[model samples]
Target chain A: GAGVSQSPSNKVTEKGKDVELRCDPISGHTALYWYRQSLGQGLEFLIYFQGNSAPDKSGLPSDRFSAERTGGSVSTLTIQRTQQEDSAVYLCASSLARWDTEAFFGQGTRLTVV
Target chain B: AQRVTQPEKLLSVFKGAPVELKCNYSYSGSPELFWYVQYSRQRLQLLLRHISRESIKGFTADLNKGETSFHLKKPFAQEEDSAMYYCALSKAAGNKLTFGGGTRVLVKP
Candidate 1:
């Protein structure tokens, strides 16, 4: 892809259900990131992946939130037992490398839990 | 832990007026700072980085280590410049990027 791509631009899920958000980073990019954008709270760092391995998962809000990247390319963010507060725009970004490089963002997936 | 803060939630200015968005960060080690902007219905894009010491679209940000602040400023605000601005910090080595609560700028004609 020319830029980072996120699937299901909009997702609506019921409480207690699990949802999966996908991200396809640019080709040959070695680093990927996930973030949540909610009202007032701003953009919260969720996870960081360096070549299919996530070294930084401290930003995951709770046990219900988990993510994984495969082939150092596509990534998935899964949320279990979704709550109303979980509704937010999930953003994915990719960079050439981890060290101080510019990150390119996707259109973002707006997940709404009702 | 590293954290970024944008004190203003909204900034309103008329066309040709000067606009400044304040950003502050809390980090123990050296950090790289960047400014990102998002226009309506568009994805977020990098505006400038402190390391570059360059201006973009008439906007520039200076990283002050003394105050731990990276403030974005533009001498003349344009209607097209109305967008949500975010300040981000990246630590040395391979570390996650932290973003501050964005500031929404509204440039009126």
Candidate 2:
């Protein structure tokens, strides 16, 4: 892909419903990151995947938030029992690799929990 | 724990005026600093990185290790420069980044 691509650019889900967000990072890029952007807020780190290394999930806000990267290419973020507070933009980014490299960001998924 | 701070939430400048957006970071090890911008209706994109030390769209940032600041600067502000700017930092050899609160710049013509 020319850049990072996220699916369901906009999503509206009812409270308690589960939602899945997808990200396809730039081909051959080895590092992927997930972030959450709330209204008028800074980007909040969610998770990161580097090649086949164990993912860094320290930033996940709660047990309901989980993510996984398959084959080191595509990734999915699953939110279970979503809450109104979960409404925000979910962004994905990828870089050639970690360490001193530039990252390309996707359009982002705006998830609205109604 | 790495952290980035952008004190000003909004900055307004007249066209042709010099502009500076402040950013500070706190990290124990050597850090990689970057500025990302989000234009109206556009996706967030990287404006510049400290390691590259290259200016983009007339914007440049200097990373000062002593002050732990990476401030973005431009000699002349343009209306097109109006956008939300975020400063971020990552520890050397790490992938995760901590981002600042972001500053919205408005250039009046």
Candidate 3:
């Protein structure tokens, strides 16, 4: 694709239910990132994937949140036993390189937990 | 640990006026700072980075180590500049980034 793509642009899920958000970064891009934005808040770093493996997982808020990228392309963020606080826009981005490079972002998936 | 801070939640300016958005950070190692903007209904995109030392759409940011500030500035603001701005910090240690709370900039015509 020309740009990063995210699935389920908007999602509504009940509290305690699980949710999965998908992201497909730009083709040939080597770095992928996940960020969360709460209502009226800044972007919060979640995890990063260099290729198909996540080398940085320290940003994950809690154990309930886990993510995986397969084939260094498609990535999925899974939130287990979702809480109301989990509701936020999940954005994915990809950069040409690992550092000091411009990153392109997806439109983001607006997750609503009720 | 690395951290980024955006001081203002909202900033409004008239067209052609000068605008500045403040960002501060805390990191022991050398830090790279970046400004990202998200226009209405659009994806967040890079406005500029300190390393590049380039200006986009007449916007510039200078990284001050002593003060730990990286503020985005524009000499002449346009209504099209209205957007949500974020300050991000990255160090050589890892691939992760620390972002500050965003500031919503509104440029009125």
For all predicted structures, in order, the TM-scores are 0.96, 0.96, 0.93
Which is the leading candidate under DockQ?
Answer: 2
DockQ per model, Cα:
0.74, 0.76, 0.71
- Candidate 3 C-alpha error for residue A43, in Å: 0.5
Q: Identify the runs in model 3 with alpha carbons over 4 angstroms from their true place.
A: A52-54
Q: Candidate 1, after superposition: displacement of residue B65 in Å? A: 1.3
Chain A (alone) TM-scores for all candidate structures = 0.94, 0.98, 0.95
Give the higher-TM-score candidate: 1 or 3. 1
Quickly count the clashes in candidate 3. 0
Write model 2 residue lDDT over B1-109, tens digit each, in one string. 8889999999999999999999999987898899999998898998999989899999999989899899999999999999999998877666677789999999999
User: What is residue B46's positional error in candidate 3, in angstroms?
Assistant: 0.6
Better of 1 and 3 by DockQ: 1
Candidate 2 stretches greater than 4 Å from native:
none
Q: Considering lDDT, which of the candidate structures 1 and 2 is the better prediction for this target? A: 2
